[model samples]
Target: MDVVTRCVHRESSVEEIMIYTGKSKSYVKSAISAAILLGMIEQLNGDIYKISDDCYGILNTTPSEELKTSLFKSRIEKWEPFILYLKYLISGESSVVAIRKLCSLYSFNRTPVQIENLLKNWAKSTGILDATGEIVDINLSYDENEILYKLNEETVNDTNVSLFMINILGENIFSWLYHDEIAELKKAILIFRDHPRDAIQCSGRAFEDVLRRISIQSGVDTRKLNGITQVANNLYSQLDSTDNPFIHSKLKNIASAIGDIRNMAGHGKEAKSMERWELSSTSAIAHLLLTLSTIKGIYSYVNENRYDF
Candidate 1:
C-alpha cells in the first residue's frame, strides 16, 4: 500500500507501478496481493484497484510522512495511554516529585502506586526504561533520586537560556504575539544556548517584528521609519524627556550594546562572535526593550507592584 501510494494518486496502472516502484511485474503483483490481504486496497476491475478509504486518509494527513508511518506502525503495536504520558515527557517535567504532584492533582480515584505503574509502562514502551523499569542506555543522565533524567550539557545550557527568557519576558508574553511569532520565538529558545549565533539572529528578527507592531500601535507612522533601530530610537526619545538623564543614558547604552551585538552575530561579519557573555547580556537588554516597547504595561506593573508582591 505504501509503495502504491508513493507513486499512485487516484489510480495507477500495473505497468506504471512497475516503472515508478522500480519493481518487477511479479513483485508488483505480490505487493498488490499483500495490500488486498491487509484490506488496504480493494479490487475494482481486472487490473485496477482502489486504496481503502482509511488507508488513504492515513497516508494523506496533516503530519509528516515519517510521523504518519510511525503512528500507523504504533497502531498495530498498540501502546496504552497513547499521547497523554508522551506529552508529559516532552514537557521536560520528569521529576518523580513533580509526577507525583501532578498525579495527585489530576489522576482522580487512582492511587500513587497505580500512577507509578502507568508511568513505568509508558517509560518502558518509550524505550526510556527497560523491561525491568530501569533506565535504558539512552544518552540521558540521572541524579541521585533516580527519578528525573538530568539534562546533558547542551540541553542544560538551552534550559538556562530559556529560563532567563522566561524571567525577563514573563511566561505569558505569548499572549501578545501572533501565532507565527510565537512559533519563531519557540524555535529561537529551543536552539539558543546550543547555537547562539542562529538564536541571536532569530532573536533580532523577533525584536524587529515586535518593535514594528508596537510602533504601529503607538500612533507612529512606522512605514516612514527606515528600520527597527530607528523605530527604537524614536520610542526611546519619547520616554519622558524630563526624566533623569542618567537613566536615559543607561537605557541608550544597553540598547546600543544589544543592537551592535545582534548585528555582528546575525550578519556573520566576525568569527567567534556572540560569546556566552555577549549573548546573555544582549538577551537581557533585548528582553527589557521588548517589554518596554511592546508590553509597556507589564514593565509598569512589575515596578509599581514589586514591593506588594
Candidate 2:
C-alpha cells in the first residue's frame, strides 16, 4: 500500500512496482489484487492507478469491526481452547491433563501431539506467543513440555498485571510506539509484572521512554529537562492554558510518583507504607499514560467518542 501510495498520480505498472517494493512480479500482482478487493486502490485509465480516499483513513486508524472479526476467525476463533488452557495453566494445571481436557472439550478426538503442533505453530509464527510461550506484547509468560505446562513465576505471582497486557494484545496498541521503543517497553513490562519490588523502577523507566516519544511528537525539548518531574512541568506549561487544571495536576502527580519510586529503587530502600496493590496500580497508571499518548494523536476520533483514557 505504501508503494502504491507513492505511485499515485502515475502509472502503477508491475515492473515499476517490482522496483519500488523489491518484490517478485507475482507478489506485486497479488498485492494489487488484494488492494483492489479491499478498495484500497483502483485502476485508472487502463494502466495507471491511485489510492482510494477511504484507504488513507483506514490505514491510519484502528481496524474496523469487520476486519477484526475476520482476523479473529482466521487466527484465533478455533484456537480459543488453546488460549484457555494457557490461562488455566496459570492456576498450576498439568500440561498432559490440560491438553487431553482441551481436546475433549473441543471434541477434536485428536492426539496430544496434534494439539501441541497446532498451538506450537501459532506460538512460533505469530506475535500471539513468543518462542517460550510468553504472550507477546504483554507481561505474561508460560513454560510447556511433553509432560506439563505452567505459568512463569512472574505471571503467577501477580495476575492483575496481565489485565492491560491481555486486552491490548490485538488492539493496535503498538501503533503508538516506535519500532525500537516496542522492544524496550516489552522488556520493561515483563520486569514490572514479574518483580514486585522492582515494579516501580521498571514502570518509571518505561514512563521516561513514553515521555521522550511524546516530546518528539509535541515538539518539547526533552534534552533541557533533567528528569521526569522537569519533563512533566514543561509539558503541562505547554498544554492549553484553558484546560482543566485538576486533570493535568493528576497527570503531573503520577509523573512525580514515578520518579520518586525510581529514586527509592536506586538507593536500595523500601517504602514500608506501600503495598504490592499500590505498586500494581501504579503500573496500570503507567500503561494508561502510554495509551493516552497515542489517543491524543487522533483528536478527531476522540472528539467523536468518549474515552476514559
Candidate 3:
C-alpha cells in the first residue's frame, strides 16, 4: 500500500505516490506512521522500512507458572556444576582433574570431609583437572626427562587419600581416646574422695565433651574413626585389672601416632609412586586402616571391660 508496507512484504514501493496520488505528503506520512505503530511496518529509514514482528504467531504468548519455575531450576542446576568446577580451580588443581572430581562427587555418597581429604590428596600430586574442566596439573617427580603420564591416576581417580590426612584422623581419635582414659583414671578417686553422684555427672560431662568435639568438626569422616571410638560404659571395672597399663600408656601413644600419620598424609609428606600404577589410593587406605585400628583398640578396651563388675 505504501513505501513502508511494500518494503516489509518485499512488494513494490509507492514510487509513483507523488505523481499518481493527489493526496498531500503529510497525509501519506501520517497513515504510514499509524500503520508502523500497529506493527504493520518497520521504519528502517525516513523513506525505507519493513514489516514488523507481527508475522510470527507467538508475538506475546505468556508462559505458564510451571514453565517459569522449571526455567529457574534448570539454571540453578547448571550453576552447581559450574560452582564445583570453580571450587576445584580456586584450590589450584587442573581443569581435567577438576572435572574428574566433579564427575566423581554427586552429593550421593560423599561428605565434605571425604571430599576435602580427596582434594588435598590430589593437590600434592599431578595430572588432575582444573576449574574449567581441562587437564591442568602434572604429577612429575624431580627427575628430568623421565616421568611417564597416565590419565586415570589423577586426583578423583585415586581410591584413597595421602598420609597427611592421617594427622587429622589421629587427632580426632586421640581426643576421644584421651577423654575416656581420663574418665577411667579419675572415676574412683573422684567417687570416693568427693561424691559418687558428682563423679557420675562428671563422667557424663566428659562424654558430653566428646560429643561436642565431634560436633565441632562435623565434616570429619565418622567411618574412618571407628578404631579408637569404643568406650567401656563402666570405668570401675578396669582400675583393678591388668588393662590399666594398656589404656593409660600404650594406647595413648598409639592414638597419638595415628594423628601424626594423618597430618603427614594431608601435608604431602608420604606421596610416593608404585611400580604398576600411580600411588595415592593404597597409601590412603593404609593410613585409614591405622586410624581405624586406633579407634578399634579404644573400643576393644571398652568391650572387654564393658561388663566388668
TM-score of each: 0.39, 0.38, 0.21
- Candidate 1 per-residue lDDT over residues 178-230, each given as its tens digit: 43454455455555445656666665666667666755554445677754466
Tens digits of per-residue lDDT for model 3, 1-309: 333323433422334333333457766665455445334556664565555564222222244445434332222212233334434564566655755666554442445454444444333222243443343434322121121122123431111111111222232232234424433323412232234333333334333344234423332233323222222212212343353432434555655454443334323433464223222433433443343454445444543533111
RMSD values, in order shown: 13.6, 16.0, 26.9
Candidate 1: misplaced stretches above 4 Å?
1-168, 239-253, 268-309
Q: Quick one: best lDDT, which candidate? A: 2
Over the full model, what C-alpha lDDT does candidate 1 score relative to the true structure?
Answer: 0.49
Candidate 3 achieves a global lDDT of 0.37
Report the C-alpha lDDT of model 2 over 1-309, residue by residue, as the tens digit.
444454554557767778877889777876676456445677777656676775544333345555533332233312345455555445456655667666655555447886766555544454555677555535344321210112234333222323233334322333334433443443444454355446445545656676666656566677877666777667666644345321255566666666665665544434584533344544533543453343342221222232333
- Candidate 2 has a TM-score of 0.38
